[model samples]
Target chain A: MPSFDLDSYLQTQVERVEQLLRSRSDEMGVQVPPRLLESMRYSLLAGGKRLRPVLCLAFAEAVLKQSNVPRMVEDCACALEFIHTYSLVHDDLPSMDNDDMRRGRPTNHKVYGEAMAILAGDSLLTDAFALVAGGPEPVRGVLCRELAVASGSSGMVGGQVLDIAEDRPAHIDYLTRMHRLKTGALIRAACRMGVLAAGGDADALARADVYGDSVGLAFQIADDVLDVTGDASSMGKPVGADAAAGRFTFPAVLGLEESKQLAARKVAEAIDAVKTLEPHDGPLAALARYSVERRS
Target chain B: MPSFDLDSYLQTQVERVEQLLRSRSDEMGVQVPPRLLESMRYSLLAGGKRLRPVLCLAFAEAVLKQSNVPRMVEDCACALEFIHTYSLVHDDLPSMDNDDMRRGRPTNHKVYGEAMAILAGDSLLTDAFALVAGGPEPVRGVLCRELAVASGSSGMVGGQVLDIAEDRPAHIDYLTRMHRLKTGALIRAACRMGVLAAGGDADALARADVYGDSVGLAFQIADDVLDVTGDASSMGKPVGADAAAGRFTFPAVLGLEESKQLAARKVAEAIDAVKTLEPHDGPLAALARYSVERRS
Candidate 1:
């Protein structure tokens, strides 16, 4: 297997995702309300790990047997980012988590007011489908279906509903199910979309699906751990928010040590799942491990 | 032109739409949170004119030269209604219009609480695309793109932003543009999607586009006029909401008499635009006239 530098790979792809998002927002500037566009840009352009888009592009590259990302791959990546960003924006609304800060800056609603924030989130979600629909016709329907299913009622939004209804501590089974729908669905969809965009065979998609599911669960566990262990300044938001909100979390259900152990086990399983892709999947393997180990 | 029973036609199709919507909601009930599903069902199954879905099916019937509505056409129609209903739910949030009632009952947020209402709206909007993505492959991409563009920032959401920003009475041009994006875009898309679903040729689609545009503008003008002239009991919501909200409106910009006159002229133009469809389009013509003439 060829040596892979995960940091460099992420940095390069994150830049591409950022540039595409910025340009797309600019393209929409003239057509949308100035404040609405500004609110969208504020949240979309705000810095994050860009993990979903990177996972999308990386999977596409692996499936296509190419070193360079294809144009359609970038479009799919941007769509994933848009959906993820919109979810975050809506999650931070006063009616939801009511967070004032994200990425160490004021949330979209805090800056643009509640109405514009809601509209901005709505725009981002709608534009995501529009972006995917603009891709090659052969895969447009597939991509659209993947995105819509992952982000819609039975997926992200349903998870949100479950989360908000959590007035008491939840069982491990309930927490797992909630996280699978809320966070795992989008992550898994991002992986599947990359393979679909590349027209990869069913076997390749199956492998990617397993890899995504394992990694998604591991990622949430790691997030839960970080919320307990990390500092507010480093996390770019208040630490222990889950505890403060009295929300169900991995660490809450399984103690911190057990949560860490479970996350490690899931990451190992994710890496093993992707081993079939071998030489071309170095970045993916690295990503799975990074999910559980990342400080932020 | 063959005599058309607009009332009976609307009655039967609306029944079909209501049944489909109910079944789909039930199908989703198992997967979604109970409260969230209730909120979505509350708004989606609520009684309304069902005009958008009806327009969609009518155009498809005309284009296909068939008396029966195809399943995909009905699917597209339902998707249009879903988008429209979601917008109304979100728009009624305290952060937005703060409306307490809609369709002669409490609004979603008023009944289900703010967080669940927001999730319900988000789920509905996302599911609209999911529903379209399930349509026939040949038209799925086209339908998805049209719906997304019509409902996205550059369309409905953009119009909403413009609407919310109106602290003072807006000029005619600004108000026109706002209504075009807010209300007109989805109406126009409903007509276009109907043609697209039927695999109508370019000429048919072009003619439908013009018909939709004229009717859409007329519909909004009529709505503005009704806000001033109609009763709350019949309209299903309080009248003069625009005035109470201090928002820019067609009547505010054009005055009641001029707005009424413009709506009549547009309805005439809309009827003229669909004349090429002739005998099969009688229902459509009546719908155009009704846009300006309906009591609610």
Candidate 2:
């Protein structure tokens, strides 16, 4: 089998997700105040890897085994991106990471003021549900449940609290748990939601779940590794910001070499989990490898 | 035929909503970090009128014409309260209204610090979707859409931005538009969601919409009037606080007497709109009057 062109796949998928994110909010008939909408669009349109939505689209295509996926998948993909973007906006706030820079640009709060930034994050998060809930019936509710549970208190938000707790332990188990919830949950939801949106069967869903879990963990470990080893310019943010903030990270608790090994192992597991759909190197497999390979 | 006991109805419904909110998060299987849960409960269970949830329940009962409402209505009612509580938490943030007190207690940020307060608010908002999505099918998606639309960017958050806009006009139209999106949108959602959950048809929904709009505006105008004339102890926050903050209030723009008169007219209109539900002074009618007549 021919090797998949991972760069071309990512670029195509990213552009698709970007277009939907840019226009879907207007299509939904929801009214946002002008300045508030500006604040939301500023952060939302500020570029990223678009990883979650790309994963969602990839999963949908893989499950359908076709080029054209359903509109439901498209909506869920956009919703996943919105959720991911809102987290970034809130995480960069003055009360959270107090980040001044993100994605090679000024952070949302830095550019829009803390209040507008907070509201922007709030709007993005709320509108995500609007997007998912607007999808086709039955699966729409399931998607909402998946997105909410993954991103809500027990999922991403819970992980955030753990990350910020002063008394939190710096052990590997604690770090893994925090990362699993903080970043892992939403990524898993993104993959699973795509399958659900595509009307995939239970077996397909279970496989997607496993692939999501492995890739999600690998992505975070790679993030931690990048924070330690990558250059600031390539990474778009300071290389050691996490360590400087005393954040509990994989490299901090498990050493740099061990973290790299764990990420590689997770990538292998992710690739293996998706082997049924694509025996040879496929987009999913390449994405798993790229999760660790990417500099930022 | 007789005067509805507004106080008793409020007490019974508020207690039911309070109980549901206190326990529903656990029932939803959404895991909240302990401290984060406490921070959310600190403001959520701090005890306001529980007006939004109560309105939801009342509408559900009115539409069903029975004592027992569906569990879906209960879930949505709790979801409405969750959204309202979250808005209050965010609104009181240091970067926003900077209110040190709410409902006679130190505000969320004052108790949990700014970061936890923000997370608590985020959790509440996200978990509200969780609750709605966990409800019975078809209607579950509809309920999620309604809740999200009413509370998202164009709804409540949009209104907050308008309220805080530096160049916002002090006219009554601006105040009305701002409140309609902010407090009005969610309150309207509470009423419409109850009807939707109960399987009420278009006419029922339209009536609820009218009732919601009229009552929502009246409530805000009365609130503005209270800010001018009510005592701090009774109100649970300082009287004249809104005016002191240079907020554009109905009373400030229309004068106290005119504001009171406008609220009365709105209350009358709300009661009239809901007459089909209970021809005489029903719970809905009494609640409309209470919008303007209440001391706090």
Candidate 3:
């Protein structure tokens, strides 16, 4: 097992983010859509690792150890998860994955119908910006530019759009492009924005971003491995679902042995990326190893 | 039968918007998602009366005759239409209206998958900010503030969210609340933003907002009327679909007779609201009358 205490790190960040999302989100006149807000909250607070935002906060704090970093980081962090979960919600809809199960429950659309699911995704994505716009003005532009690029066409949206449309035979470059934009953008943003929020730690942020990119890619590759070898009972979700969907996964293209070698390479790269950072973020370095090496 | 030439006006705006949309929306670096951009363009260029953005620009030019407005005004105008069309695209998705037909073609999700459709909506919506953010510093703040409110929870997204989850029988207040937020907020922004972009007289901007509120409500009322009476063939969508969806609409609560009366009253108010502004923009006042009274 990796030596990282990410679970504890996640616990503290989740509490902080929950408070931030609740206190900061209220507006003066508009009554928030209760169901939408409730649904978003349920997904966000639903006991996941809180990896994305925690990584963001950790990366930001690694170099510029200020008290205000956590104070200012929640909206951006939670908003990343909101966008991620929202995509998951819509992606699982019948027209796409048609999966009834997610994190061991029927997906939101299955419970709420398609319109609410669609709108939930829409609301979550927009609420992300609204959250950023409401943040302190200094970092607002940087956050907007990064998050928008990550979430919009150039990043996650672009990758997913191509994922849906592309019937071409699998290529690493194409899949890597998709992975970096779709899954990796927000992950990388979490680190980069964290550093930015800490009031300009460019070197630390760049290092964090390297860690993020390598880990994000390794995370995907590990999932492809898990889908190939993971047991359905232990995986929570079905195993081999990606293969069933005819997805061009790492193991499918590279063979399991090659995929494992690539995963190991990425884990080393992710760990090495942040070697220059001080020992205070030792847990984060361990996280890089866990990302590629985890079985479930 | 309305005095103004609605078809020709709509045609002119649509042509201009289509021309603009075909060009790349200038972003700092991230490549525009090919499918998302293509989908946005497909819907943006899809036929609709460019009333919202037209109102924005026409009033802007009418109010601020300072001769300093940049071509970005045209882009802002195009941006409003993009926002409106994006909402419609998402609203028409299977998870929402589940309608296959929109403007006589397949709805975006019907053509693109649900994930891409959601992203396309998200892309277009956020891209509106990118458009406004590109403007001069003076106007960007006003543009950002106004667009954020209109597009965010207090405005369109909030209303649509409520409309989807209201779980109520057809109720007048619910319908009004939904319409005001879902449709009226953006309409109000269209008028308000036009004046803001032009740096128009403050009083004129307020009056234009009043005009927008009235015309916007009247437009909804007319849509409700069309829901009962329009030819699906000519309307290019399912006319009685609202009733089928169990949605609370103006005509359902007001009764057809009362709904028509209310629409006419609102149209008169719209005309009255804009009449304060003199010879500079006779066309806008004329257009409001035409927008609510159009048979198609």
Task: Give me the candidate number with maximum DockQ.
Answer: 1
Tell me the tens digit of each residue's lDDT in model 1 across A190-239: 99998988878999899899999999999999999999999887799889
lDDT against true structure, model 3: 0.74
Candidate whose lDDT is highest: 2
Query: Which RMSD values do the candidates have, in order?
Result: 1.6, 1.2, 3.8
TM-score of candidate 2 on Cα atoms, chains taken together: 0.98
lDDT for each candidate structure: 0.88, 0.89, 0.74
DockQ of predictions, in order shown: 0.82, 0.80, 0.41
What docking class should model 3 receive? acceptable
**Tens digit per residue, CA lDDT, model 2, B8-87:** 88888888888998888666434667899888888878998988888888888888898699999999999998899999
State TM-scores per candidate: 0.97, 0.98, 0.87
Deviation in angstroms for A295 in model 2? 1.6
Q: What share of the true interface contacts does each candidate keep?
A: 0.78, 0.91, 0.42
The top-ranked prediction according to TM-score is: 2
TM-score of 1: 0.97
The residue-by-residue lDDT of candidate 3 on B185-277, one tens digit each, is 899988888887777777988898898898888888988898889887878887788888766888778789999998899988888887767
Q: TM-score of chain A for each candidate?
A: 0.96, 0.97, 0.90
TM-score of chain B of each: 0.96, 0.98, 0.91
Candidate 1 docking quality: incorrect, acceptable, medium or high:
high
